[model samples]
Target: MTDGPQGEATESPTRWKFSPVQLDESEILRRGLDAFAELGYAATTMRELARRLGVSHNFITVRYGSKLSFWRAVVDYALAGAERERNQLLAEHRDDVERLRGVVIQLYRMSANAAEMNRLIADESTRDSSRLDYLHQRFIKPFWDSIEPALNGLMAAGHIPRVPTHILYFAIIGPALALAQNPIADRLDPVATPTAAQDRNSTADALSGLVLHGLLPPSGSETST
Candidate 1:
């Protein structure tokens, strides 16, 4: 079961067991993400990750077989988690336009916080052909495919204009890219780094308003947004 930010345990008939095997995998990924983020994918070594995690290099070798395999797994996990969140947000707010706006806003906020993850993607795309391919196929392609239909439904029901959903996606993500390029913590005291949730909703609200205004079709216009 999941715990909320306030430390409340979620209600569930089936409790999540803390399996040692699962914990090991989680530890490796967590450490790898940190290392890869601080030092781009090429500079991040499995041996260094093992050292950071206080584990033997053999531990990583046994789990993923190679450094490349470990990197692939990290990318896969990050993308998979993003997709899952997107799907859940859409399912929960399928009929509410405001809720959908909130979802997009939240997505932007999350993307901003995922600077290291984004850095890995951007840096690797230039050097690793397979990584670029994996990003498109595993992350971006599926994300747009899943969300586009929900957006289409809003148009069909007259809640919004027929503007391409991809445009909306770009508008939402553009700000995050800007923020990721120059992270807030880098300019502040390292100990004072802000939490990801702080200022997230406000930023999202502003972006949502901008998008909705631009995307809403003119009153008498028959064209889709």
Candidate 2:
């Protein structure tokens, strides 16, 4: 607290005043993710979410206003860095097609870490709630808007068959996001450490390979990649 070596007058360390800026918001929301993932939206409470974060019971309501607002904040906080990262991944490639491929693989890689958010949206989507509308407007539609043009171009060029964007989206999203919903993939091939980076990448790459390449011989399609 004091740098006065002469000790003429100084605030001592023992008498130092301290104030935390605020409780860590991101940490609280992450635990919110876990709680919502396990308990679903109808069941999770702001108090429980705050408690799980080891903060005051009123923390969520005070900072975020309401349960729905807190959920939106959780989603925004969880995904804040993803778009930039995806753009960074896209920047690595020169070819348009290669960029698409890179982005797809990047998405699968993203899903590895984003399974909770993915699963959350998936759960909400089936219910047709205002929350689902928020997710669609804020997250889902933007993703399709970003990628659909490329997909259409690929289709026009005969790189991939003409297909619905939702179909293609779910073709990858379904299997990749199942990590948060089910254990069938794990049961088929168990992972020693579920949260390890290596394991996550391996799972993502495998899923991407299947979705991108498919089972049958591409004949000459490998050259496009």
Candidate 3:
């Protein structure tokens, strides 16, 4: 008999809840790039990216519009720093040989820092799709374009062995790519891994040695004197 007016119609308690914190745009883009690098374009979706960023899928969709655009944003974000570094190196090192060496060293350091991006590029290279084309045009071409002039100047000045720019590009980047893409490359090489403090310096030294030795003008060459 105690059903008087539905228990006096008690008011529900105000449930205090914290709003989801907004993540920084740069942080979102950085995490997106890392996810794309690890998962590749096709395998990674907005949902997965949002999950990686600890946001909702709508966040990515609303911010980036579509997956293609998101992928482009990720690539652009990842390459922006590289483009700046390349330009700075080119500006700082006017001498052809010195510039080329600086570029090679910079690239080696970049490759070490961006192994996941390199892996993503390696993955993209296997397929001839627009995504790959986008990356080539947007990311890879800018880098090659910046270095081509330096490489050409080196070849013209006889500071480096006269080889095709493409060949020279590979010569400078190939070893670093191999080391970055292959986790076991350090073990495969004769040299032991360096301490954490010397990791970058040691890599720069090894890559610089390889490049300098390979590009040094052969004996009796005009530039060798």
lDDT of 2 at 189: 56
Cα miss at 133, model 3 (Å)? Answer: 3.0
Q: TM-scores for all candidates?
A: 0.62, 0.76, 0.74
Model 2: how far residue 224 lies from native, Å: 18
Q: Which pairs of residues collide in model 1?
A: 162-225, 163-225
Please give the CA lDDT of all the candidate structures: 0.65, 0.70, 0.71
Q: Which 10-residue window of candidate 1 scores lowest in summed lDDT? A: 13-22
Clashes of each: 2, 0, 0
Top model by TM-score, which number? 2
Q: What would you estimate as the lDDT of candidate 1?
A: 0.65
Global lDDT of model 2:
0.70
Error of 3 at 216 (Å): 2.3
**lDDT per residue (tens digit) for residues 113-160 in model 3:** 777676777778779999889978876788788778777776676776
| Residue-level lDDT tens digits of model 2 in 119-165 | 78778878978988988887678666666777777777677766666
